[model samples]
Target chain A: MIPYSKEVLQHFNKPHNYGKMKNPDGVGEVGNIVCGDLMRLYIKVAKDKKGQEIIKDIKFETYGCLAAIASSSMLTDLVKGKTISEALDFDRKEIVEKLGGLPPVKIHCSVLAGDALIEAIHDYFNKNNKLIPEKLKLRHQQLQKEKQAIEERYKKDKAV
Target chain B: MKKVYLDYAATTPLDSEIKKAMLPYMDKEFGNASSLHSFGRMAKEAIEKARQQVAVFLNCRPDEIIFCGSATEADNLAILGAVKIAQKKGLKPHIITTAIEHSAVLEPFGQLEKEGVEVSYLSVGPEGIVRVGDIEKVLKPNTVLVSVMYANNEIGTIQPIAEIGTLLKKQSQKIIFHTDAVQAANYLGCDVQKLQVDLLTLSGHKIYGPKGAGVLFIRKGIAIEPMIYGGHQENGYRSGTENVAGVVGLGEAVGQIQKTKNEIQNIKRLRDELISNILQNISKTSLNGSREQRLPNNANISFAGAEGESILMALDQEGIAVSTGSACASGSLEPSHVLMALGLSPEKAHGSVRFTLGKYTTEQEIAYVLKVLPKVIERLRGISPVK
Candidate 1:
């Protein structure tokens, strides 16, 4: 049996922000049924009276286990009142800790939720004509490079 | 919320009486059954008594029963053993089996096929029942064995073993009929003579017994070469230190179920009602396997447009334990091939859930499941993109 924390189980049993947003400013969809998990995050980024682009609302739909649902639910709470930049800076460890930590096998769901949030913010900027932020782009590229290195190492090990 | 365990097809909880029956073997009387001392005599007597109990359940002579580590090992011994005997007699080995056999049987056959042995895979129709005529059609000049399962573990479809056994009896003297009866032994009476099966396999764990013990029933005079080479044990057919506690547990478990078959029937009645209510109350849900031609306590349902894992997780939250299919392959991303063989699309196959009832399953648990399940299915389907 999977020992999900009470907080995770609670959100899994009763998820918050669990539907598609209407005419959202940004939308991110990741994973699929074939992948054993999927998440769609929608955010409405509005210009606050101070002219800062802040997330006015957030919602998510995830098809996975308790950790996936809870991670997505917790994503909503973290991003709802934050500026687009703050939401983009949100880390998965904070989400996992808030839920009192998920099982190791289910940690992938948290990473997926975190990636979806950043993707949504990127979508927000792409729609607005602002240049893609250089630091986030470099960070994404760095992750790709590390992933490639890991794949190369795996291939070499397999060959050996 | 109350917890309901409905994955008996995967395994059953160890019966307490069986545990009690096995206590002495695990502790004080742990002497080797093969020794010549007084302790050995006591252990050997217990082994013989357990063998008698298994034979009583199988309705066969005790001499025909051979203990093995598991049904998989038994199946390998039966199939490969038959092939090896035929090969020694200068015969080309040919075997027939169904498409939906457990990997324990299929994987061994698959390896044999790679070694140039011919294997004819008889396909089942959408109802998941293998036609006896297909077996007859595939029977050949060199056919040495016909291996089919007595019951399917995934969708709970019981095969027409009596008919198959009768057909195999008339096919050829050389063609031995073997059926993996692991899932059927708990609910179905496995009288070897009545079924006309030359060999049968039973797993202890499937019938509330220990995990590491099983029986392979080879009718007297059927030639089977031993797979493992070692000192004589199991009459030279299998070799290993005997799993005495496990065998004892199996014998006691079988005896307990045999005496309580009537009470089990009552549980089956509640099982049938639970399936009926789920089908009646839930829309877009259909039974996966044969309704009438299945284990009395098995229910496999496919809820269209809802992922099986999600429904299973939801049910888990409510403490209603169920399964997507064989626990062996649940972690894989692939849908159950057994469901796909029964003519379900991959989507429908992925949406399938199996609920297998056991002796301990209760009507109140079913009521709790019925109360919680439809809501979970509806909520998941509401979020599903397919609908």
Candidate 2:
């Protein structure tokens, strides 16, 4: 078994902000079942006192190893009250740091968590008819390409 | 907190009795079995005695048992050596083995295929049992050997070995039948005459003996070319100085199985309870192999929407040891081929876990596992996105 940190185990054992939202403001789902690390992010966005958009609530559901689940939970906690732009800047490295650390092989899980958050923000922009940021648009395309590559690999493994 | 070990199918702790039997050889009686002195004669006698002890379980003669370095080597000697001998006798060498065989057996056949040997890999049914008809359908005029494992290491599914043995015995063309009984030797009776297998492979560490000791039983009058060439030890079949201490430990370990036969019922009861409780208490969980046809000490289950490596780590944190089908545990990225061959989807295969009981496993340990397992499943499923 991989040596999981105490904080990772805590988040994995009693994950915060789990389950689906009744009607989420923005929803983003990433990963495929074949890759064994699918994740879905739900966000409730609200305007703050100064009328700036802030994340009022966030929840995540993940299907993968301990590191994947811990990362998702930690990612939700990291971006709960942050402004939309701040959450966008919430990088994978910060998720690793918050969860203590993840193994090298599980670093991709933190990446997945970050990707899901970005995709959820993109969904918010698309639903509101706002122009998506150039950086997020690029990240979106990269995630799509990665998902496509994973699906192709799954097809090849099944063929074998 | 006490640690609970439930991965006996992988390997086992050496038995103290076997250790006691092996100490003299490693210490004072350290003479070469091939020497002519009195010390050498004593060592040779001890080796022969061990041979006879191992032979009793298989109902074979002492001379028919050839000690090797490990079960993997024994499997290679049986498959590669037999095919080579058949090729020497002007017979076209074709081999048949199941898809779920251990790497020890499958890799050798793969190597043979590269050498122009026609190899047929038989597929198993959903229960992980290879049908006798499937083996019969793949038989050819030049099929020189059929290798099947008596039981699987991952899922603990017991194959139809006796039936396959009988079918091969009825064939007009001579085909050497071999079974890797490394996992089966713990609970199953290995009477070769009853099974009708020409060659059988067994491991020492699996049966509570030391590692570096194994046995390949070649029936009388059957010949296979030697894989190792040296001082003509093991009747010129496995040519090297024998690991005398390991051999003695293995022999004593096998001999103790008969005395401990009654403990099997206890293990089976605990195993059954574990299976029933996990299936009953946990939702979206399913057993992996044929429940009735599996090893008495094994329970392999797949938890939907939860990855196996995560479950294994959670259980490990609780001081309970188990195994998972996830490739991450083995430092690979692919799930187990055995679970995949059973027609499980990639998701289910990735979610599978195996719990194998052993002679030393206690009822208290099973209860503790049962108490902690459902919570772990719930915790993981809560985080699962698949639902």
TM-scores for every predicted model: 0.85, 0.91
The per-prediction tally of clashing pairs is: 0, 1
Off by over 4 Å in 1: A5-7, A34-38, A49-52, A78-160, B84-92, B113-118, B326-329
Cα lDDT tens digits, model 1, B21-115, are 89999989998989999888888888899889888988899989999999899999999999899999998888999888999999989999999
User: Model 1 over residues A1-160: C-alpha lDDT tens digits?
Assistant: 6667888878777778888789988887665554345678899988888898899999997765556778899888877888877877888888889898887767777888888787677777778778888977665565456456755653563353
How well does model 2 score by local distance difference test?
Answer: 0.91
Error of 1 at B293 (Å): 0.2
lDDT of 2 by residue, B247-326 (tens): 99999999988976888999999999999999998898999979888899999999998899889988988998999987
Off by over 4 Å in 2: A46-56, A77-101, A152-160, B87-92, B114-116
DockQ per candidate: 0.21, 0.58
Give the best candidate by lDDT.
2
Q: What would the DockQ be for model 2?
A: 0.58
Model 2, C-alpha of B70: deviation from truth (Å): 1.9
lDDT of 2 by residue, A23-64 (tens): 888999997777667899999999999898999999998888
* Fnat for the candidates in order: 0.19, 0.67
